[model samples]
Every structure is written in C-alpha cells, then in structure tokens.
Target: MAAQQPSEKILVVDAQADSAKLIVLQLQEAGFAAVWARDGEAAIGMLDGDDYSLALLDIRLPKANGIEVLSHIRESGKDTAAIMMTAHGNENLAVECMKAGCVDYLSKPFAMDDMLQRVMRAMTNRRVLLQKQRLEQEKDDFVSMLSHDMKNPLTAVIGSIDIIREGRLGTVNQEQAEYLHAAIDSCNEVIAMIDNLLDIHRFEAGRMQMKIAAYSAVEILRGGTRRFTRIAEHDGIRLRERLSHETPRIAVDKNAFSRVIANLLANSVKFTPEGGEIVVSCRCLKGAEVPWTRLPSYVTVPDGFAEKDCFVQVSIRDTGSGIPPDDLGRIFERYVQSRSGVGRERGGAGLGLAFCKMAVESCGGIIWVESEAGLGSIFVILLPCYLNGTECTGK
Candidate 1:
C-alpha cells in the first residue's frame, strides 16, 4: 500500500518526546496530516469531532493506556485504525493491545521505515473497509426506498384499480374494465422490476440463501399462468399451459422458482405481438435425455450429475419474435436487454432474466434458451429430481 495521502489525518498519542515527536515529524514529512497528543485524555479530546484515518498510541500513558483510548474510540463509533507501541520487553502486552482493537502492536525499538510501511498498509486497509461499509449501507437504503416509497404506493393503486374493475365500487363498462386492467398490469411490471433489482443485488452479494424443498412443478406452472392470464388477455396473447398429467417434485427454492416463472412470462408478454401464443410446460427426463450436453457453459450442471439422475424440465415457449442467435449467449448477463430495438423501447432494466438465471442456478439447476431471429423463443430450466417423480407430458 502507498503512504497515506496528505488529506488523510493521523493521531499520535505518546508522552515520550524521543519516539513520539520523531514519529510525528516523519509522518508529516511523509505527506500525512498528523496530530500530537501528549496523553490518552488529549487523544480522546482530539478525536471527539475530528476525523482521523489512523491513531498511534503508547501502551503506557499518563492518564489512560492505549487500550482504554482504543476502547473509547470504538465505543464512540469513531472509524480509526489503531497501532499500539509497547515497551521493549513488554511482549505480554502485545496480545492485550491487539485484543483492544489495535491494528498492529509494535515494540519501542522498531525501525522507523518498518513503522511507516505498516502505517501505510493499515491506512489503506482502513480506507477499503470504510468503502465497503458505505457501499453496503447504500444498497440497503436503495432497496428500502424502492420497497416502501415506490412499490408500496403503486401496489395500493393497483388494488384500488382492481376493486373498481371488479365492479365492487359500481357497474363498469367493458372498455373501462379493460383500461383499468391495463393500468394494473403496467403497475405490476414496475413492481416486478423493483423486486428483480433487489434480488439481483442480493444474489451478487452472496446474501441470497436458498431454502431448498420439494415443490410440485405442475402447481408452480399453473400458478404463474394464472398470474399473467389477465395481462395476456389484454395484450391479445394466448397464455396456455401444456402441463403433464403426472406432477413431478423437484428440489428448489420456492420463491426463487416463482420469480423465474414470472420473469419469463413477462418477457414473453412484452416481446410478443398481438395474437402470439406462449406455452408453459413441464417434463421429467433422465439427465442424459435433457440434451444438457448441447447447452452452453452458462447452464452447466454439477459434474457429478449422471445419466441415471432424474431431472425435471420446465419450459416457457413463446411464439413472439425470437432473439437473434448472436445475442442468445449474452442475454442472461446483467443489464442486457433484447437485441432488437423493440425491446429497448418497451422499457426494462434488463435484470429479470439475469435474476432468473441466478435463482435457477443457485438451486443446482440449469437454465438455457433456444432462439433464432424471426422465430419464437423457449426458455428452459432443468432441476435435479428430488427422487419422487411422475411421468411428464410432452408438448
């Protein structure tokens, strides 16, 4: 790490003029903004309102020891790195100093050059830690604002619109009902986008813990189809299910799988022209029969997976304008929308598919899509069967 920048401040707390004064002089000469405190009380006073990147203190002080000063700084929530200097034969105090939150415990007779190097490294590390903390706080604030300020109000608006359309408030004409439904659908799209953004952030940060359980693949498909039925009807699209007669149970995170289904359906609805058809289907197959070998590396299954492992395959096929073959490989990446200009105009942050991909993969499943320009697309997911399986219907 480089030396602390001139803008960064350091606090030196030691009564010994021989070492403390020389160290302070060297720090300032090395371009660091340094302060001198003759005792522990002075050090704490200096830290009250000012911000310092690092603090160097002596283990034996007049008023308070280095440990006490360090503890006070921590208790007050001050962000500063502490490096304690101990007496020459005070090896026993090394562990105590460290336990009190010192970044480095050094002996009195240490080389000035070595001390400078350690200070520089400590400052660098402290800055990096503070940066990470700021980023995490920003992420939390963003998600909270989206959920409370944006999604909540829009959700209430949608509910009121639904009530009116359902004729609870009064009788409504067909056109009025259609308009209200369209408005509701648009609000739903915004909510889904917000959810995708939050989930994407969590997944990237490795904070999305999946609770795997056996779920009925057929039930999940039916539920998703029901959710988009109204929107599809409004768009003149046919949302049909070609589910199998036998239901297959697959190990997955229920919420994650639901999001995947919703996202795929939304993408289909947005890109499909009027009169287009989308088919939601489920099938169970032997791992060897899944055509997994033909899929790209993005949809890689566990290497331990064998042909004997039974897998459940869920597919959402849309008869809309398909994705360009060249862009198929990268669509699952974050912030990547449709290759066609039409997708851009339709409005999306390009996080839905990426979230779906991660959610599926996190459950030890593989997701892939097959498409060509001018042809419709089919998004497919294959999850390891939870042993209990039933025969699946083919499309």
Candidate 2:
C-alpha cells in the first residue's frame, strides 16, 4: 500500500464562480486539498461533513450571507479559520466579519500574492495554536500521572500517623500527643495539596483512564460524607448527601474517583461559613453540553465521542461566599486562589479544583463549576464509564 501523504485542506466559498475558481487554482497549484462551495449554506454543509484547515469566505453569497455562515461556524464549535473577502465599499462588513471570528479579511480585486499571503498566515496560525495546545496537554498529563503515583506513599504516611495516634506503636505523653497532632495536621495539609496537584494535572492533561468495577455511587457519597463528618460538625456547617436513586454498582476507581468528589466536598466545607450548607449529590446529567464554541481553530475531536461521554457527572454545591464570575474560568488554574487575601489567610494553595479536573480527566472525564460571588458555587465532574485503558490516538 502507498503511504498517504498528509495534505493541507482548504474550503473556498464564493457566489462568484470565476473568483472562487481562481482561488481554487492557486490552492491546488500550491499542493493543497481544496473544496469549493458556491454559497454560505454549501460552505456550512461542507464544513460539517469534512475537516478543513482554512476557510476562504466571500462576504456576499447567494443563499446564506457570509456573516451568517461565520456565526454558524462559531456556533457549531469547530474552529476553522475563516478569511473573509469583501468588495471596497464593504470594509465595514469585513470588520463585522472579523468580529464574527474571521481570521483575516481581504478586499476584493486583490493580487493572487496577497490572497496566498493571507491563506498562508491563517494556516501558520492554526498550526502554531495546535502545537501549543499539545505541549500544554503533555505537560499536564505528566504531572497528573506523577501525582497519582505519589498518592500511595502519602496515604501510607497518613495511615502511620493515625496508627501512632491510636497508640498502636506505643503510648505517648501529653506533650508528645500535642506535638504529634501538630505534625499530623501539617502532613494532612501537604497531602491535600498533593491530591490537588494530581487532580489538576490529570484534568489539564485530558487523559482520563477509569478502572471500572461494580460499586454504589450512593455508598461512595456516604463514605465521602462520613469522612468529612467531624470537620463539618466542628465547623458548624450543615453537610448533606443526596442520592436521586439507589445508585447502581457502576464501574469506577473508588479511591481516585472518590478523591475528586471528596476534594469538591472539602472545598465546599472549607469555603462555606459556619451555618452554611454544602450539598453533595449524584444524578444523571441530561442535556449537558460543553461550550466548545470558543475553542480556537485546529482542534479536532475524534469519533465515538460526545461532550456527554466525557464522564458520569457528579456535583458538589456549596452556599459559601461564592467565586466571582470573572474568576470562574481561572479558578481551576494552578495557584489561582480566588480567595486571595482571605483564602491565603484560610490557607489554600488553590490546587483543589485543578486537582479535581486532573483526576476526572485521567478517568476520561471533565470538570467545571458554576458560581457567583456572594451567591454560591457548584462544582461538577464528568467521568467516562467502562474503566478501560486509555485509547491513545495521540491526535
């Protein structure tokens, strides 16, 4: 079999047959795989059916307007770079096209050189963006996997401290108990941080692997709730766990997966004031979709995937002094502690949600949150079922 050569694919749309044909010749002459569409509707149909590296759009088309096509492209969540062509009087329309997410604009009656330049620029930008995304993804995956591996040791260390506290090793004096308590507290803090790092790293990496076994979601929820009972009581906060159904034995990694749920729960408890309420719940996610609209050009999602397949969704909601709207996107970023002066005072490194993201992603899932400052916050995680090994298409 002959090796298939990789080729740059460009889509050309123009109502004017001559202009479109000219551009197509240039692209083909330059060794690109080009598809020509006569109008906006045809362009959109082609885009929906095939992957194109760049789209050359004429602002005026017969069936659908260029701006309308651009809007549809933005809405469909495929970020194909669009270069709009406008006649002289349509400069303002070109600006409008740019606002509609056109990568570059070309005035009509332009030289072929100018057209080639713009197309080349758009293609170059797309490649650069894709490369940057891959690099960041790789870094996140490495860190997340490392964090998961480190957890066993952290768990053992914490477990040993508990044994000593119970006098399993030997009896100790009051002064020793106090010192041990302080040491254990410090260790717990570090462990929490490590957990956060692991979660964030995995989430950012976008490589979630699940080790599915039959287990009750309700049991996991209750276990997580019970684990935090003492702290909730101490803090005077009301914590509730609700199960919409007797959750079936679903496939999951109890320890790694529960940690994500626990992290959200812990954050709620930490951020919520005394007398505030924290609710942890498990329910089916119906009609849930990601805002892939803003994704830049050059990203491609594989088949057998839907935004929903990202995970079995879990949500942790809290009635704490909530996060500001502006900070919602950045909150999951490492060290972006929204609490800032207050959060620092409360002692947070801002890795909790980031970690949640990583852990969820490692299990082939996603994590996101909804919150308004002074209102409250709801952190949601989605993990895929059937905890199989990662399928590495490697883009």
Candidate 1 minimal-lDDT segment of 10 residues: 386-395
Give the alpha carbon lDDT tens digit for every residue of 17-108 in model 1: 77788998889988899979999988888998699899998888888878889999889898888998888888778777777787887788
lDDT per residue for candidate 2 within 1-395, as digits (tens), equals 12112467889999989889989988887767887999888998998998788888888888898888888888988868889998999998898778779989999899998898778888889889889989987876677665666766766887887788778899977777766765665566678787666545544556445575656667888888998876676678898877766333345577877786777777787788888888888764432454445322322333344533333457788888888767777876678777523234567777876666555555445567777788788886644433244422223
- What lDDT would each prediction earn against the true structure? 0.85, 0.72
Stretches of model 1 off by over 4 angstroms after superposition: 1-21, 28-52, 55-132, 306-308, 388-395
The top-ranked prediction according to lDDT is: 1
Q: For each candidate, give its TM-score against the true structure.
A: 0.75, 0.49
Kindly report which residue pairs in candidate 1 clash with one another: none
Residue 43, candidate 1: alpha-carbon lDDT: 89
lDDT of 1 at 302: 63
